[model samples]
Target chain A: MQGVRIQQEMSLFEKLNILSDAAKYDVACTSSGTDRRGDGKGIGNCKAAGICHSFSADGRCISLLKILFTNECIFDCKYCINRASNDVKRASFTPDEVCRLTIEFYRRNYIEGLFLSSGVLKSPDYTMRLIYETLWKLRQEYHFQGYIHVKAIPGASQELIQMTGFLADRMSVNLELPTAESLRKLAPHKSRKNILGPMRLVQNKREENKQEIAVYKHAPRFVPAGQSTQMIIGATPESDYQIIHVAESLYQKFQLKRVFYSAFIHVNEDASLPARTDEGPPLLREHRLYQADWLLRYYHFSASELLSEKQPNFNVLLDPKCDWAIRHLEWFPVEVNRADYQVLLRVPGIGYTSARRIVKARKFGSLDFEDLRKMGVVLKRALYFITCKGRMMYPVKMEQDYILRNILDPREKLPGGLGEMGYRQLSLFDDVNFREVKAE
Target chain B: MLKRRFICTDTTIGILSAIYDAWKMDRTDTEAGIPLWGTVQHEMFCEYYEVEENERKAGAVRKLIRERLGKQAYSDISYAILSKDEDKGTAILQTMVAARELADSHRIMEHLSHPAVRRVFEMSRNVGREAHYWEEFLRFREMKPKILYAEITPQNQVLPAIADHFADRFPLEDFVIYDKNHASYMIHPRQKKWMFMTDHEQKWEAAKELSEEEEAWCTLWKGFRKSISIKDRENKKLQTQNMPLRYRGDMPEYGKS
Candidate 1:
């Protein structure tokens, strides 16, 4: 193709354009929790609170120099834009080129670190070696102490993955599809065992390195921020229940710091993939899953509690917490003054910060609804579920549907794009600026 | 109930020394005996006692705070000093006084019921949040060889909090982050220590014309930003929520790319 042929003689910027666009669908650009400061002789350092240098049009935070090492692949994954079968432009960055780009980009303070991933080229070994060389050069030669999150080629040798782990702050092996069956159907070259194998290796290496550092005090860190993995959502017909459980298992088994979910975009024409629709890539579903995941990680919620085979999906109208609260009505009207911290956390409006604030504020005096509002509780949502001094904010019934209807008030303003006339086509009246006057 | 107002400079040390002078003035007979106020304008109907900044007195109060409370409280006080709140100096003093009587006073950070304690805590958290955001939002342009310059207009005075992070991240380069609102700047010279210059006479120079290579990189960055978005998920509302419009002016991706 013309695009493919022109790419062979392309400039570095052109290559970057193609490769970064190819890589964007993966959706794991976080650069958090790496505390490796520059060793005075180095060029950069990583702080715990990751810097988001900019935001893309998609509203995703750009924290790293997220680019694929190359777009030349050996396998044909149906969902991937960079699949070998696709007649798209291909480009690869040399080790020195990647180093130079990272150093220069970092010097201008454009990025916090580099997130290097790639499609397989020639062999997994060769592709991995090139990545390792780039990272090794960046760390050893350039002395770039900034965060580096690299993707581990699933079937790459244990030695190559281990060597690269020492040079990176974080490593990820994309568990692209959740289940083994879906992975087989979509990515024929990728296997669940091959992916999990390297993930296990990284986990073990981190464990061993932790012990080594406990004794030696300088036994080079292994993925100091720990490994994170991403799973493609809305693909292969996996239920929300299944996806949530898989993420939980990954956290429990692999010790992952994060599990990113990418809403499946129908990029290619394949019989196995879902039909393309104007409704877009299950963005709302992906949002719900992230909310549920937050509950799992921070709110001490179990996946079973959030979802079950009986009720497989979350309520699209209400948040996961509200839905849960509606289902388990007996848990409602939790006395704010009497409930424990964990109980307070389960209340809809009281988040981690406000729950703690409530507990601390109650120490000096008894807190009313007004006090709860002052302490940052979302009273509109929390009113039905919480009580101040054993009195509900309103004389409300304990019926589920009633409470749900009350919570989803007709007058209550919904988040943008979820309200009336949300997806309306352009109309003559849409541009009119009508001013409503109040009657005296 | 005429209050004895201690007028002091705006720095943390100035306020602390004022607190020290008030504590030693023996004006306990009056109902609202002594209150610390910064030189900055404030509504007042009280006798003003000008307290010159005494490092010795400030040091004594600092030691008293450390002895009664702990190191963490001292740091909280330092963070509170960076708050733009007009009542910050008084809030820190009252918080210190209240903290002495509280049980496990070191953890007096959790005592949000006391108005002063809450104010100090909220002020510190606000400053800390701004510093955290600046760590992420501050954009640097190479003005000269090995010299990187960034400009920030943060809500609070946060240059002092974020300077070490950049210096540590780029130890071999000279970087300066100017806080336009506070009229202060932090400079980190190559391989040398980082330092803060407050109320300096230097006016900010316009951002230099980007080098050809820098221009190319900016173009590439903008391209990456444009190419990354799934057009169907273009939520300008959400984008503005995450990366505010105020921060977009300096960001290359949002600039004339």
Candidate 2:
């Protein structure tokens, strides 16, 4: 690959411009505190939650030199700019070019490391090999110790995927679509088999590494940052049930560090894609999915609890947890003072922090309505479900829809007469006026 | 609104000094702070007062945090205040004061359940998350002899902490991270910029910055971002959140067509 490229013809700045830009959208670049050590004379250490240089507006974090091996790809996916059929300029970087740029950027303290991906140049194996080789050079010849997140090209040879496990700190194979059929439709060149094939192989390899380390205490490394994959939500017609079901399996089977949900974009305005008229995208739906994802990962809520096949979509108005609580009335009104941590967590307006607060505050004093509010539980949703000293706040009937109305109500909410709001319930342009709101 | 000025080495240390002095003043209800306001003069009444910075006081504050809040708390809150979010400073103050009621450090997260505390906790989480991402997603290029330039538009005031992280990690490199909302920093480990950018200005000259080869690379990145997959278009909402519009100006993938 290096032989095919003109190195002297390209400077370090040129490589960075093409490579880093090409690489930016790959979501796998994360450097939480490896906060460990540089190990004698080696370079670089990781932070636990990771260190960030900046944030992209959509509020996604940016930490590394995220870019692709080249913007040149063979696959003509309907949503991608790099698809072969697209009329776009292309650029590729040699292994040496990436190495010099990464080292220069690292030495200059510009980035934490390199997050290298490609647009599926040539074949899957060909693309994977170039990325794998880049890491090998950075690690071996340059003695680069910074974090590396390499894209595991789906359908790439198993040997190539294994090499990623061995060299990179993290490896990812994006589950471009939530379901098999959608995968076939949007990314026709891609398939469930092709994507999951590398995914399963990486998962197995990571498991073997974990097992090896468990026994020997020091085993051959295999994606120590672990494997993560992304699911493009909202692009196809997959229901939340379909999304969560896939997520549940990904978690159970892959031991993935995270299964990122990248909402799809209409890059080409294909006749096949749905046209969103009013809103540019479904931010609320995305928020709900994140909430559900949190439920699945941290909260004990299962995919079934959050959504069912019958109800394919989440309630646009009510949060997933609140929506779940309303459906399961019997579980509510549990004595907060005595309920288990998990039970307390199940209440709406209560998160992990509040759940622990209830646990701790309860030991000091029996929690009532006032006590609950002070303890950090927002009572709007919890009001109907909880009681103070064996007394319901303002009892009345246990009508699910009635209680759901006020909690999810948009009319009376907000500061200075902001009308019925969106998913987060703040008025439109809330993000724009955050400063003004804070002042108030 | 009263205006007071104190000179310190740099931004973080300066902010820390001001915070320390605010702690020492023993003001009740409202805090005694500096207004990162004022054109050239450092003075009063903002949406909120920027804290007054003192070196000894700031150092003591750091010690106090390490003692009371634990080491992680120190790093967490410090990083939180530096996020690109406008509310970063005020949010940390609330979180810090709330956490003080508890003796143990972990109790801070418990305080985080409260709305005021939650705001700061969210800020910390945001900054921490962004820091993690910034450390990963930053695109860097060696402009000329030793000029390492990178552009970023974060939602929080993360550049300072990120700078600190980068300084330690890359002691030899001199780089700049542009905060699109505010002004860009002229950063370098050799001679770090040592003042608050209260009088900072913006200079976005495009022609000189991009060479022909550099332009080609950006074109490829842009092309590639357009190709990934379309069936996932329903997730545009998620995509929008993950990569907000405000950032497109600097993002190589969405360069001017």
Candidate 1, residue B141: the lDDT equals 76
Best candidate per TM-score, number? Answer: 1
Q: Mark the regions of model 1 whose C-alpha exceeds 4 Å error after superposition.
A: A1-8, A409-440, B26-45, B199-212
Q: Best candidate per lDDT, number?
A: 1
| TM-score of candidate 2 relative to the true fold | 0.63
lDDT of 1 by residue, B199-254 (tens): 66655453566555667777777777788777767777777888887766677666
Q: Please state the error at residue A158 of candidate 1 in Å.
A: 1.4
Candidate 1 docking classification: medium
TM-score of chain B of each: 0.86, 0.64
Error of 2 at A325 (Å): 1.3
Q: Across residues A321-388, which tens digit of lDDT does each residue of candidate 2 receive? A: 88898899988787887989999889887888878868865654476677567655788778888776
True contacts kept of each: 0.78, 0.10
- Ten residues in sequence with the least summed lDDT for candidate 2 chain A: A412-421
Candidate 2 lDDT: 0.66
